[model samples]
Target chain A: MLLGKVKGKIISTRKHEKLVGYKLLIVEPYYGHKKDTFIAADKLGAGIGELVLVARDYAVKSGLDKDAPIDALVVGIVDREPEKK
Target chain B: MLLGKVKGKIISTRKHEKLVGYKLLIVEPYYGHKKDTFIAADKLGAGIGELVLVARDYAVKSGLDKDAPIDALVVGIVDREPEKK
Candidate 1:
């Protein structure tokens, strides 16, 4: 899992039916120099600017009854912020 | 998902009970300068030196009855090798 900051929410009008109730959050990695961001399914009610833990791939389908196309997921909200280098 | 080459198998004598019956394989990324390797749970009977797709995080626990401590999983074995750069 990687540490990330939720940047924003995604609104998709057309998506898989199994993804209907899943919240999509845009995340930026906290420790990397890479500036690109990715979207993650959020079930813990994470908010923008909050530090969260993101998991990737089919692990994204864990805890769901049906399979979805999600490649990333917001697994947890960090209880404390880490010091930056 | 990341493409990886299965380097070897891991033998864990003591692990989580939910992890029993899962095949553990060490993986090396296919397209990176990083030489470090990580272990992934494999269910599709992949073999050493085979190219496979790896999923990370809780997505690793997808399709399992109980949640395991695995952070990675081999979801597929590549049928063809990509052209080398």
Candidate 2:
């Protein structure tokens, strides 16, 4: 898992049928220097600027239709920042 | 999902009880320059030096015990490299 801040919402009118009701959030990882960002499926109602735990991979597809093409998922909102080196 | 090269194996005799029998492999991402590496749970029987698709987050927990603490998983062995810019 990685720590990321939700930067914005993605409005997709046309997406996989299984992904119809899920909210897609653009997240920027806290640990990487690259400007690359990815969209994560959110079920926890996380908002922009909220820090969240993003589960990547098949884990993102958990609890949803098995055919969903989701690649990242917001599992939780961090209540506190973890101590870092 | 991200593409990674399996570099080594992780032998963990003591782990979450739900993770006792899983194989863990060290993986390096193909698109990053950082020397950082991570362990991924493998169910596809990927071998060292092979390229594999890593699913991150809750997606990694698919098909396993729901309580397993796995964060990365090997979902597929790469049959072809994706075209890069």
Candidate 3:
């Protein structure tokens, strides 16, 4: 799982068929000091600038089709921002 | 996929049974300017400092046991350094 802030949303015209209904959010890491941002699938309605938990790997696919081409997903919107390490 | 140079090997005394024979290499992303390094399973005999390709998510598991706890994998070693974008 990754602690992140939903930075923004992405609009793609051509995407996988399985990704039709999901919103794509740009997530920035809150803990790892990583410079890159991840574009992840969102089904729980996470809004921009919100703190959330992102699940990676196949574990993220259980909520969608098995072959959705999604490597990251917005799993939770934090009730409160957790202390950063 | 990720383009990276193998940083080093990880020696773990206790790991998942499915990961027993696979070498774990530290892969630093060569693109996306990501600061985080990934611990990825390597079955292609990639050596330290070698440029390689890493496949992430469930797509990485096709070469191993599906239930393996591996999310990153060294899929191919580059023949030469490709042009970086």
CA lDDT scores, all candidates in order: 0.69, 0.68, 0.70
lDDT value, residue A79 of candidate 2: 58
TM-score between predicted and true chain B, model 2? 0.85
Place model 1 in a CAPRI quality band: incorrect
lDDT-based ranking:
3, 1, 2
Model 3's CAPRI class is incorrect
TM for every model, in the order presented, reads 0.53, 0.53, 0.53
**Recovered native contacts, candidate 2:** 0.14
lDDT over C-alpha atoms for residue A19 of model 2: 88
**Candidate that would win on lDDT:** 3
Docking class for candidate 2: incorrect
Q: What is the DockQ of each candidate?
A: 0.06, 0.11, 0.09
Here, model 2's chain A TM-score works out at: 0.85
lDDT of 2 at A84: 30
Interface RMSD of each: 9.4, 8.4, 8.8
Q: Candidate 1, residues A1-85: lDDT per residue as tens digits?
A: 8898886665544333445687766577788633335557778999988999987764556745577545677888999999995
